[model samples]
Target: MLVDLHSHTIFSDGRSTHAEMVEAAIAKGIGIYGIADHLCFHDNPWTTRLDQFEEMRSTFANLKANTTSAKILFGMEVDYVRGCENRVLRLKEENHWDYIIGSVHYIGDWNIDSNAADWEGKDVDATYTKYLELLEEMVDTKLYNIVAHLDLPKKYGHFTDIDFTDRYRAIGEKILANNMAFEMNTAGRIKICNEFYPRRDIVELYHQLGVDVTLGSDAHHRNNVGQFFDEAVALLKEVGYSRICYFEEGQKRYLPL
Candidate 1:
């Protein structure tokens, strides 16, 4: 059984529509799929109002109420902005979703994950330190079920000399403490880093910490719905993961791999 729980559509930065995403998931033989679109506070120059949130809720509710396609769930890939947890929480509270994916995309109203120029003239070490700190804080918020793209700081291939073991260990501990799962988001395979979201060592650490595991493609287009999923599954197996998790009606369930 194929499980892909992270994807986007025209709702956010994705390139496909909701119908297109469903068709692509069915085409890929995915038994379980999730439409986890972006939900953030920092405008990034784009703002989603309460009304828009309700509209998104209607789409999710309608999909659940009316879809005859493969098993699908509605979720939001919410960004964790430092010092704005309460505001972000309020924004997310407007909707009753199947699940929530907490991610750290900003450090202080600054988008550091994508666009090479974002890293230009920036201190990679300080940025990474703050990113990890915010990641730990985001998990501490305990407002989300899963953490998306664990190594987002590396999304644009920014690496510093700082040791990641302590930082990742702390982050992993927090995720475990909060009962949040992190997925092997394969979208990184297409990024400059050209690796999974977290890379292998971090996955290994999570397994050692007994953290729950899930999977995603972070697909923005229909064709990429289940892109590189097989590789992610194999990588999980190699890392000692025996089952993958999914959500249904806001409840977490696992399927043996």
Candidate 2:
């Protein structure tokens, strides 16, 4: 059975409604489907509002109650921006979400969705360094169940010249120290990079560091629900990973891969 832990719905920037996303997962025979809409500061356009959260929660509850074959889990993909601890804590305290995926979608003064031409040419090493700094902060805050797409700056195409081994080792150490699971996100294959997020080298390094791993599609549409999931499982098995992590009531649990 396959489990996809990172997905979005119309509550954020995704194209599909929550029910459509869930139904598609069921059709694909996915064992567990987690809905993780974007969560960011109120000023961000993609930030999921409280009403949207309630609507998604209602949808998940109904699906869980009515569906016997598949399990639908409610989660959020929160951007780890500066000064986000209180919001993270509040969301966890107030909601009965199954998991939270913390990601660094913005740097010191740059956002991932920016279209400025020069942004693409920025130094890959420096950008990754800054991203790692933010990742360390995310781990220190202890506000999430998993770290989504550990090496996201590679999506910008500037990291082709950079060697990520040492850097990934450092980041993997921090993740292990915090007992946080690192996600092998397949969304990159369909999105900007046309490759798996974090790539293979990073995944092997994480395995070497003894860091637990999780698989996520980061799916924004119904067709992409389980994109590259079988390949992801194969890669995990190759790296000696026997299980993937899941979240229940804010705690992490291992499930057979």
Best by lDDT: 1
Off by over 4 Å in 1: 45-49
Clashes of each: 1, 0
Q: How close to the true structure is residue 130 of candidate 1, measured as C-alpha lDDT? A: 88
The lDDT, on a scale of 0 to 1, for candidate 2 is: 0.82
Q: Residue pairs in steric clash, candidate 2?
A: none
Model 2 residue-pair collision total: 0
Global lDDT of each candidate:
0.83, 0.82
lDDT of 2 by residue, 19-110 (tens): 88888888888888888899877466677887766777778789878877778888888888779799789887777888889889888657
Q: Which candidate's TM-score is highest?
A: 1
Badly placed stretches (over 4 Å) of model 2 are 114-121
What's the TM-score of every candidate structure? 0.94, 0.92
What does the lDDT read for residue 85 in candidate 1? 72
Output candidate 2 Cα RMSD: 1.8
